[model samples]
Target: MRSLLLALVFALVAPALPAAAGQTLTIAKARALPLGSVVTVGGTVTTPSGAFESSFFDKGFGLQDGTAGIYVSAADDVHATPGRRASVTGTLKDSFGLLILVPTDVSLGRQGLPVFPRWTTTAGVSESTEGRLVLVAGRVTKAPASDLPYGYKFWINDGTGEVQIFVNTQTGIDVSRYHLGQALLVTGFSGQFDTSYEVLPRSPHDILG
Candidate 1:
């Protein structure tokens, strides 16, 4: 009788247990979950670890799968580079306006080619593009009046609409060469800052005029 009672107790309590670690969720599905929910996602690393000097991105990197992409924050603990496949478990967060994952555990997998940048128009860059690499070509519609402490901010339009291009100072990409009306081909990670959606080039090579 005691054995049966114990078995019944175990069965009743098992349903309340949290999910096992490492049960993977696609990047898009994880993004849709409520904040503070623990989730595990597997994807290819889109940005090199420690690439951005800002504390906001320090130790963090970007990851993307077939469904979507997302930035992993405060993940200096894991060694990741562009093209590396990784399985990360973390809690979802909204840093400023950008959605990010704060990792608690990370596991690296086989290396592969980095995900190709998707070609899209300036206006095509929306919430869906965030955390993914993209290629855009447009004329410089608005040039930076002055450089901000973080970097330069400019606008580009490809007739469909206009989008902001933010050249972070840490990347050492000089924006002075890009002037108003100049046609430019740019490749970068589609990201957001506060309320504005912007493209962030990883290096000077990401820009071609």
Candidate 2:
């Protein structure tokens, strides 16, 4: 009787399981996919410098592609570190307006190379460009000043307009790196900060002189 019930349960549930779980998705494709869908995405970890195990993040790191990037969430520990190629399987989750992946499983492959940034102006940074890994070049208008209530962030003006650029403590960047009146070119994942949007740069390499 117990054995029969186990078989019956598996029969009923197996058909409902995702069939295309093995299909590979790029960061851009995954970002466009509908919420709650389970898909495998391939990308390179770009932030935290190494494996991320944070109370706020749970356990995960940032993943990026030539077109875009997204935060990957691990329920527990994350083995994949920055620059490592990751074949990640997860369900798309909108965590309180923040798009993150809840990873079911992740397999690391070859080391990943950096992606070319998508060129765009400050005026072009809109909802359409959200999550895109892009480059915005302009003068440091406001310099390293916190427009937000707090954090290592500043404003950049690409002649078109202004966009906030944020660098986390883990990225090892400082306000001194950005000089006022200097022509600056910065790259990172495009995301939101509160109701306003912001750009996140992972390292100095992102800021071209």
Candidate 3:
């Protein structure tokens, strides 16, 4: 009877196990998920080199994506450090009028190759610039120019499309290495800052060959 009871316990528990305990998910997938769903999001969290704030917060934190800002939960203790890739696991919560993943478990991950958005020059992006993260490949229209105290500004244009790019000083990249008219790829959020929409490249690493 002991052996039979043991066998019954194994049979009852075996079906409930998940096939994949830890899997990576893209930001879009994480955002689309329902609240209370368990998921993992992998991304780099860099220290904000300049001052900026988002509507999601009461007092502005020193972290910002370009000049707009970043949205993080007050419950999370993970502060932004430059050039670090973190894998965070938690439940998806829609709070503070934004979709935020409340991280229950956080761990550092091996930094992978930089990911740049794939965008075509032929597409007109000005009107649809709300909350879009895009990657565009093009020839550098201009070299990096000094913006704020801790930022660099440049422009890139494919034959069909063109956009401005911004990188913060904390990325530790030499903007001089990028030559005008050189082929390059950039990834960043597509949105308006200071009444004009622009692509704020999250990091210098986002620029790829």
Could you tell me how far off, in angstroms, the CA of residue 4 lies in candidate 1 after the best superposition? 28
Candidate 1, residues 1-209, lDDT tens digits: the string is 99999999999888554456667888988888878989999999987775554535467788999999998886464668889999988899888788889988888999999888899999998897998888999999998655566678899999999999988777778888889999999988888888888887878888999
TM-score winner among the candidates? 1
Q: Which stretches of candidate 2 lie over 4 Å from their true place?
A: 1-19, 48-59, 65-68, 75-83, 146-150
The global C-alpha lDDT for each of the candidates, from Candidate 1 onward, is: 0.84, 0.71, 0.54
Model 3 stretches with alpha carbons more than 4 Å out: 1-77, 80-129
Could you give candidate 3's per-residue lDDT for residues 1-209 as a string of tens digits?
99999999999888554315578666565555567777766665433322122222321111122222222343444444444566667776654334455566767555443333436451343534333446677888888898756467777787776677766555555788788889987766554444444565555566786
Expressed as tens digits, the lDDT of each residue in 1-209 for candidate 2 is 99999999999888543446588877788887889988888887765433222222466667776666887777666566567887788899876465778889887777766555679898787777775667898888877865333346778887788988877554555668677887888887677655667777766677777
User: Would you give me the overall lDDT of model 1?
Assistant: 0.84
What ranking of all candidate models by TM-score puts the best one first?
Answer: 1, 2, 3
Query: Could you say which candidate leads in lDDT?
Result: 1
TM-score, structure 2 vs. true: 0.73
Q: What C-alpha RMSD separates each model from the true structure? A: 5.6, 8.0, 10.3
TM-score for each predicted model, relative to the true structure:
0.85, 0.73, 0.46
Candidate ranking under lDDT, highest first, comes to: 1, 2, 3
Tell me the TM-score of model 3: 0.46
Q: Which is the better candidate, 1 or 2, if ranked by TM-score?
A: 1
